[model samples]
Target chain A: SAVISQKPSRDICQRGTSLTIQCQVDSQVTMMFWYRQQPGQSLTLIATANQGSEATYESGFVIDKFPISRPNLTFSTLTVSNMSPEDSSIYLCSAPLWGTDTQYFGPGTRLTVL
Target chain B: QKEVEQDPGPLSVPEGAIVSLNCTYSNSAFQYFMWYRQYSRKGPELLMYTYSSGNKEDGRFTAQVDKSSKYISLFIRDSQPSDSATYLCAMSAMTSYDKVIFGPGTSLSVIP
Candidate 1:
């Protein structure tokens, strides 16, 4: 099992502004995942960030819109740029314990764009 | 069709009653199955995990997987109000790095 934490539990932001959410893990990991859960929807993968490589984004997500940074093994940040009401959702970060199929998720960061 | 399908139910049950949640998938390659419990406005917490077929029990939670039918279930015995939340079923094929697909969770309310 792993412990994960995210900064800014909940925030209200205006449209067109950007907010960066941070995720930290207790132990080193090769990959970290970012996910978004829109109201009444399932979690959609935003991207997968490695320590030294560019984040791999899923379809419908772009680096310029939802840029991610993984500076080290246990820390990563996702910046939501030029936010809109459509971006209002809960964002979560997860790390799969190496050598296992289990996944650990952090307390999500809820963003509300008005 | 999407890889995974689940009833996004707002199922209500009384305390001490049995609660059952289910999900189905089109992909037979998925070998690992898991259940996650998500509270309102919080990230999902892992509840039960199973590999391949059969049933695994942990306390009041029981996870069952039927790989042949591509179906999975989570049964909560002696449900409590604390069990009120959304239950999401997730699965992966071969590795953790693989694209893990999550079902559209079922919302459950265990009345006190």
Candidate 2:
């Protein structure tokens, strides 16, 4: 099992403003994943952040909207730019256990755009 | 139709009762199935995972997958109030490192 932590557990931001969420893992990991969960909705994959390289985003999500930075194996950041009410959702980060398929998630950052 | 379908149940059951949760998928390519539990204001925790088909048991939890039916289930024995949470069903065609699709999740309340 891996322990992950995210900053700004909950935040209220005005529309058009941007917010960056940080994820830190207790142990080094090669890949970090970002997800979003809207109200009463299932989790949606946003992007995959790989250490020392660019993040690979899923369809319907673009780099200009959700830019990710994975500087090292233990840390990554995601910035939600030009936020809108529709972007208000719980953002979560997760990483798989080393040498295993089991994944562990951090306490998600709840973002509410007003 | 959605790739993954769940009842989105707000199921309530008494303590010590048996609890059953299920999910159905349209993608036959999915070979990995997982159940995740998420408490209020918390991130999801992986409860059980099964590869391909058959049943996998861990403690009081049992996970079953039927590939032919494209269905999976999670059964909890002797439910407790601590078990109150949203249960999500997830699947992947390849590995966990790949994109995994998730269900709408079922909300469960185990009343003591």
Candidate 3:
């Protein structure tokens, strides 16, 4: 099992502002992912953070809006640019343990854009 | 249809009652199944995980998977008020890059 920590557990931001959330893992992991959970909705995959490379984003999400960075195996960050009320959601970072199907999640960063 | 389907139930039950939560999927290739518990304003915590089809028990929680029916369930015995939260079911295919499809969580409230 792996432990993950995310910064800015909850934040309230104004519209058009940007907020960057950070995630750190206790151990080196091969893969890391970013997810968004809107109120009362299921989680949507945002991107896969690869160390030393560009992030692979899922459909309907782009780098310019939700940029990601994986500087190393244990740390990554997601920046929500030009935020809006629609972007009010809980963003979570997850890491899958090597050779396993389970993914451990961080405490999550909740952003509220007003 | 979405790959996974689950009843987003705000199911309420009295303490010590048995609570059942379930999900269904359309992907036949999903070989791994898992259950996650999320408290209000908290990230999801892994409750149980199962590969292939069968039942796995841990303490008061039991997870059952029926691959043939494409159904999975999490049963909580002796439910407690602290157990109130949303339960999410997730699954993935082997060839996938550990990218799992999550179901809309079922909100369960074990009322005292």
Which regions of candidate 3 are displaced past 4 Å? A98-100, B95-97
lDDT string for model 1 (A22-76, tens) is 9999898898999999999988889989899999999999999999999999999
Single out the weakest 10-residue window by summed lDDT for candidate 3 chain A. Answer: A96-105
> By descending TM-score, how would the candidates be arranged?
2, 1, 3
lDDT by residue for model 1 (B28-109), tens: 8999898999998789988998888999999999999999899999999999999999999999897533477899999999
lDDT per residue for candidate 2 within A38-111, as digits (tens), equals: 99898999999999889999999999999999999999999999999999999999999687887788999999
Two-chain DockQ for each candidate model = 0.65, 0.83, 0.54
Question: Which one wins by lDDT: 1 or 2?
Answer: 2
Better of 2 and 3 by TM-score: 2
DockQ of 2: 0.83
Candidate 3, true inter-chain contacts retained:
0.46
The prediction achieving the highest lDDT against the true structure is 2
Q: RMSD (Cα, Å) of candidate 1?
A: 1.5
> In candidate 3, what are the lDDT values of residues B1-112, reduced to their tens digit?
9899998788999999999999999989999899999998888888999988999999999999999999999999999999999999998886233778899999998879
**Could you give the DockQ of candidate 1?**
0.65
TM-score of 2: 0.98
What ordering of candidates by lDDT runs from best to worst? 2, 1, 3
lDDT of 2 by residue, B29-92 (tens): 9998999999999999999988999999999999999999999999999999999999999999
